[model samples]
Target: MRVLVAGATGVIGRQLCPALVAAGHDVVGLARSAPGADAGLAGVRIVVGDALDRSSIQRAVDEAAPDAVVNMLTAIPPEIDPKRLAEQFTLTNRLRTEGTRNLIAAAGGVERMIAQGLAYAYDPHGDGPANEDAPLWRKPPKPFVPVLAALRELEQSTRDAGGLVLRLGHVYGPGTIYAPDGSLLRQVRAGKMPLVSGGAATFSFSHTVDIASAVVAALDSDEAGVLNVVDDEPARMSEWLPFLARLIGAPQPKTAPAFLARLAVGSWGVAFMSQLRGADNTRAKNALDWKPRYASWRAGFATELGGLAAADAS
Candidate 1:
């Protein structure tokens, strides 16, 4: 199979491209910026193109002429400054929404298409282990509105194109927020991150390596629709955050005054800390014949954090 990975230089892309190549798929990666800036994506044929630019995307798609196309682009580590939220969300939204439009148009001939979506966007007013059929948050508080709106657009576009949407869990792995130099880890290390309110928000975490594998599996299948790519167990913020902090040798995060957090991180941070729902991966497991390498956060969290700590300390 010949695969084209857009955002192939992103956190997950850096891992996915190599996995695809190892699986015997010829891979072509789209990059708008400097080539090989990402550590693990060296062998992929790099095509320069910003996913938001229609012409650039078309050219990239034409160059690869892939049998399958995977839309894995995202603008993450978003600006922490509240003033920049709108603009940052809009830009990242384009990668997921408009960028997806361009890719679908460019990949009309491809047999399979796999797109990245968020599992965390579901309405938080529910029980744990929500399935794909659950209702997405319609009135996401202020800052998240643009992001969720874009997510809706992206999903609609992919569904219309008969593409598969991988509504991935909050990704945590080598190149993700749990990485030694990642923003979240730095915040945790510095005691800037905190558990807002009770910290009972359910978190659905997916390892990057597992997500990369799922992307490959999605491409290999003819099944079209949405699947939540997450682990077996969903963790509550209170349970996971402190455990993660302990593993990283960081002081336990202090509980932020909920109102202050709302003012600072905005409603977005509050929702993550107090309200989000965790996704169920039963569909992906049964349909794609896939299971996460780390079924529980407990199994992998310590090892993952320990390695990053060792590297950072060294």
Candidate 2:
């Protein structure tokens, strides 16, 4: 299959383009500039285009003439301000809605279309992990409502066009926020990121490698619905935070009161780190016949941190 990938130099796309090539698919990556076309995307062809611009996207799609199009476009800032973290995703939200529409529109005659979605948007209702059938938060916290609304629009557009939606969990790996030089790592090292109360909120995590593999699976399969592309283990902040800190040689994070946290990081940050529910990947595993290589963040973190350490030593 011939695949056109938008955001081809992004965290996920950087890894995905190569994976798709290795899996025997003809891949064309869309980049807006020379820097956006990273050297890592050596095997795949690169097309210059802006996903937000309909004309650029159309021209790129026409050039690629792909059988499928994967929308991996995002504009998340590397360093998130605690006070304005909720607003940081405003551009990414736009990418999901407008950028997605542009990609779909440009993907004329394409059979398969896959767009990204977040697993953390489900309402915190039950103790168990939420599945694809679970309801989204109808009334999310004020700051998060726009994010969820944009995600809903992205999913709706893709599904309406008979495309697949991969609702990925909190991604952590070499190029992600959990990496050695990433924002979360910096916060953990500074002791700024903390557990609110007992940190009971659950979070499902996926390694970027696994995320790429899942995309490959989705592209190969005919499954055309929302699939939660997460790992096997579902963990709470209380469990994951201290462990991560220890792994990275950081001081144990201090526990803050919910009110203090709300004042520091805002209500949305508090909810994200303390109240978000985990997602189940059963549907994705069964439907796409896929299983994550790093089944838990424990293994994923060790590999990522170890690699970072090795690189530093070299």
Indicate which candidate wins on lDDT.
2
lDDT of 2 by residue, 80-129 (tens): 76568567988999899998998888885588999889998899977699
Q: lDDT score, residue 4, model 2? A: 90
Error of 1 at 141 (Å): 0.8
Error of 2 at 278 (Å): 0.4
Per-candidate Cα lDDT values, in order, are: 0.84, 0.87
In candidate 1, the residue pairs with backbone N, CA or C atoms under 3 Å apart (3 or more residues apart, or in different chains) clash, namely: none
The runs of at least 3 residues in candidate 2 whose Cα sits more than 4 Å from the true structure, single-residue gaps closed, are 36-38, 307-314
Candidate 2, run of 10 with poorest lDDT = 305-314
- Tens-digit lDDT track for model 1 on 258-295? 89888777777777788888999999998888888889
RMSD to true structure for each model, in Å: 2.0, 2.0
RMSD of 2: 2.0
